[model samples]
Target: MSPSVSVTCTSLSFAWPDGVPVLTGLDVAFGPGRTGLVGVNGTGKSTLLRLIAGELAPGDGVVRVTGQVGYLPQNVTLDTALRVDQALGIAAQRAALHAIEAGDASEGHFETVGDDWDVEERALATLGELGLGHVGLDRTVGEVSGGESVLLRLAALLLRRPDVLLLDEPTNNLDLYARRRLYAAVTAWPGVLVVVSHDRELLELVDRIADLRSGGITWYGGGFSAYQEALAVEQDAAERMVRVAGADLRRQQRELADAQVKLARRKRYGQKMWENKREPKIVMGARKRAAQESSGKHRILHEEKLAEARERLDEAVEAVRDDDEIRVELPYTAVPPGRGVLTLRDLELAHGARLTGGLDLRGPERVALIGRNGAGKTTLLRTVAGQLAPVSGEATAHVPLRFLPQRLDVLDDELSVVENVARFAPGATGNRIRARLARFLFRGARADRKAGTLSGGERFRAALAALMLAEPAPQLLLLDEPTNNLDMASVRRLTTALESYEGALVVAGHDLPFLRSIGITRWLLMSEGELTETTWEAVADPA
Candidate 1:
């Protein structure tokens, strides 16, 4: 147990420009060791990180931190021209200068600060520790693979050795080996670690899990496994509470109905007695008084019970909001292969002249092209889509094919959802196009909203709708890293839709759970200028 660094927050709230509130009132404390931020995609995990990083100010409440913090963003784009050593050297020099300016310079500064020589050597040593010793120190960031760049960023951050390390999906693009290496380094880190990731493997290394939902934080001691178990228990409790609330509401309604019936009968009897005039005045007055007393008492009791029932219902509904998992159902419109969809024999793809080896793809087969980042997965997708010519080998696809690239590049940022759909499906009218977009969850005025204003998830959904509207409708679909930004529900829905599709599917993604859920039968693992069919044992069994 190391001495912990503490971060305390009280009554924090944040809202975007669209008046969408992210955090309502969040209060939590972060101490030393690794702490994972876990939740669904839209649950403000990234926003909270930005807030802690001082990149964005909280609209309300206080965020207090003890020491320096190092933040590694999920998107690690870097300058391509600078060598790995140069990239880290700059950061070190900046830190050194800042230290000197702050009057913290010591005899150690003399050994580290001269002529950019000391820091560059130290950078190489740090890179070696991160399992990048083979990487030439002179190699530019852009010349390396995406996974390598991610490692480079990690190396740079590690050199800083701040009090707290904030990592956002650090292993998203890394291969299994790189991912394991990252985990090892995280475990070895001496700082207060707060990692925002959906990877279960990464979460297992954490000391605690923090779930950010509905503008609040729920802390679970222990690791990801413990958090998951606690969430299951909470979900079960929520279900029971929902059932009890519904029952109470129904009982209240029944009592109210019975009271109304009694009142009606009493009125009718009093009217009959008056009309018949067969009873004495005293008896009639006594009957009227009894009726009044009964009616008053019943009305008061009904009101009280109804109020109680309504309060219970509200509480139950609130609990449901916190407990209900996201549910997304993708449209199930599958097109069958008429003759053959695609044919590839001895095909080759590469980055520049570097050969990515030979491969074969036949029609009517769902193919999963998988590998670490920069393994030419996207390049292969482009080749299959006829957007890129293969460096060598024969390739042919007769049927119509639709391609959804890793990024939603097909979307027209200037146009609204309706316009994007209408442009893709020119035969359709505004109403028809809007109706089509609505099926993908863009409804009413939202269909008229500009695509540029939409979130990353919304953009992906809109793009899917557009692709589905192609004339001669595609019999084959190719997706590249489609699940990167999708919420868990969206991922599930997309999987379900693809599962039921009749067309041949070729997907390139690193999401293990998603791949298993969609039922990938075979995999094409891309590596250093080679593609091979590996055993599917790498996939974990679904829980």
Candidate 2:
């Protein structure tokens, strides 16, 4: 199959049943080589990919796909009935059949029989590229970690040699090493690629950047680093324009006011002179007409000036404000820690029938729960949160804690922002509830907006608000992949907030910069429920 593909969308639009248009009149084109799709959390980046993959049809407009395409969604539930090797073999067979159907028989294939040897060679090469060459042929798919399963899918896609590869948030749960390896492999890939990811490092490796926002795609003809620089420049220009425009509007308003005041004063003086009856009739009449004309002209000019000022102000406001993201302020309250906040002795987790291992964590110290996908980091968190009991061991926590799971499932999606906040802060009045919500950027009518309507970032902000609004703040905060769908700006803001937090934090995050920025002092790596003490290194300058 040809390595290059072209995709184009014209006047495309789509919306849910309630008529909330996710994409509107969007037009975008993708060519060969790697491309990064970027946008805020709820701007429909993933929706666009689905549209391209033909998983969802556009409500309006046309999407033209010029070649065979393979897509990997942000998340998938792999069939567990098949063994790892069985799944891989099934994928390979499919790829071979697909290639034969496409009439590509260069690498393997008899004159006409059996699985194409050429296709088999290509499939094995692709698997090797994904670091899955040693995957035992008999291993079950259900036995592999999430990351391993995803890598398997990726390998399958490559083997298929589709003209285009669409990957949506492919590294959401991948560790630093795994993510880096994936990046390297993708950068070296020889086909058209469109990836939706918030990993700036991965974006840096792409050939072009496409930013989807407000139902449109703005194509930046450079890599992620260049895109960042360009965005900075754009923001600076917009800010300057806003300042200049505001000044001009103020000056115009002042000038118009002064002109009107002078005209009114002149008219008053003329009237007084006429009232004395010393002036001739002609003089009085002329003076009155002159005053009337001047007043009319002044009123017209004032209106014109006001209108001009409003136009300039609106332009400046749009330029300055529309590009910026809403900032969130997470509240921090001091909490007294118990004698021992967390204590665990000889705890273990199992994968399949084997006793994977044991963990012993005892301390007043801040612990970091770390592990690869399927290594039981989340499982360990659940156990610590008391949501799940340990298989066999003693685990204890003395203080009232707050556990923010990987998914913000505790939030009431059906409630409004104010309602959600009020649920936890029953003593707070409506005004106070709104005030607290505003701190998280749910100001004005947004406080009344349903939580279900909120984007991922907004949902996270709401979650943060509810936690902080509680009278007795949580002394322990357990976060799992807290930065999952958050943009870089929000991530930085949250990191700053967490830095000042007085409570003990047990966070599991795969974002390298984020983890480092928040200052992870200790590392407790979890593997199959077994915790191991690993040296935490600065990924930025890991010499």
Candidate 3:
């Protein structure tokens, strides 16, 4: 393995085909060690990764790398019919070795198997290292779960052993076990690794943090915790700078006001002296002209000082982060403690997972649905929301409910944010709806942006606004993986917004941090064919 690898971007420029500018004149570099690339959803972390991996070409400038490069994208879709060996890019070599063993003795076979005589053993070991020992090379990809497919894809890349690796949201769809295995692999990687992910635990394993914002990367030593500490210190300093600049501005304004008062008083005195005829007309006129010139010079000096002070204050404010705030109150969403919100009896979902016996949610219980991939959490949430009916049993809701799916399909892409919200609340006046959308960070012209053109974070916020601001006010809220693609700031904002909700919430998500932050009253584990009550510790270390 190479001891050193380097990836550099110089004067990099790129944008979508539609001419939406993302990055311009950006420059950054990665060398040897894992670096966590993080930013808000629309800040182009993924785009930067793609450009480095050669998946997307930059519009201008140069991307230079010293050795072989490999990449794993945010969403991976492989042909299910492919054999494990084929997916791993070793099917032909394996077949060639088999032919040689059967006494074919072909020269082409030897060439194919050339230096990889133990290719089968090495492939098996790679799979084993990734917690996929049961995944046989000859087994078809269709036999494995989505999480296993991710591991298989990684196995293929590991077999090649590229010197530079780029991972974009690699943990997005992975389960706990798979995620642990990946974290282990990242710890052992001996190359330049650049990963873009919102998973805090995954990020904590990095050697450094690369904070990308507004076409620039700010380097932070150590992991996520260290980056946060540094950010806090920086923010405090920025706030202090702002305070100082503001004081200077105020002082300049007061001096200007005082100067204005003195100038006016001096003008009155000169006029009175001129009217008294106490001196020759020429002498008084010359004195008055001299005084007027002196006053004009003083006024210009104070005005320049105040302008400079204002400029300094603006610079200080720009240095501080301007993360959007989400503050919306819905008191009408509250429900009585004894009120029944939802009930499911002998519920066998359409996706084949069963809520065996029964399930019930009363009052404002916030239940966190925890499980592995394909555990039917989404199915169960959909069943209760009336978007999908139970296969055999009844799933009913007694209160007004709203469902936010993983895909956020509730909004119409063709419609603007304002139009979409209006669709959800037909009776709401335009002025009232605009007032509420403002709290969701969609002010005036922003509310007129088409849903299709919104960023991932923006789309989620708009969807949440549509649901929470619906005419009836959802007393029971169902969210399926709502934090899937959101950044840390957005996640915090979502948590804060949910804190104000007084109704029952059933959020089916794998984000444990988010679930806990939302103050879940109960935790339900979905596995096998049953829904079992569990605790936070159990979810943390499920056997």
Top candidate when judged by TM-score against the true structure: 3
* Span of 10 residues, lowest total lDDT, candidate 1: 322-331
Better model by lDDT: candidate 1 vs candidate 2: 1
What clash pairs does model 1 have? none
**Candidate 3 lDDT over residue span 370-452, tens digit each:** 78888888888888888787789889899999999989999999999999999989999999999999999999899999999
Q: Each candidate's TM vs. the true structure? A: 0.83, 0.85, 0.95
Candidates in order have lDDT scores of 0.76, 0.75, 0.91
Tens-digit lDDT track for model 2 on 463-513?
877776665666667888988878665675576567556667788867765
Query: How many clashes does each candidate structure show, in the order listed?
Result: 0, 9, 0
Q: In model 3, which regions exceed 4 Å deviation?
A: 1-3, 275-277, 280-286
Worst 10 residues of 3 by lDDT: 1-10
lDDT of 1: 0.76
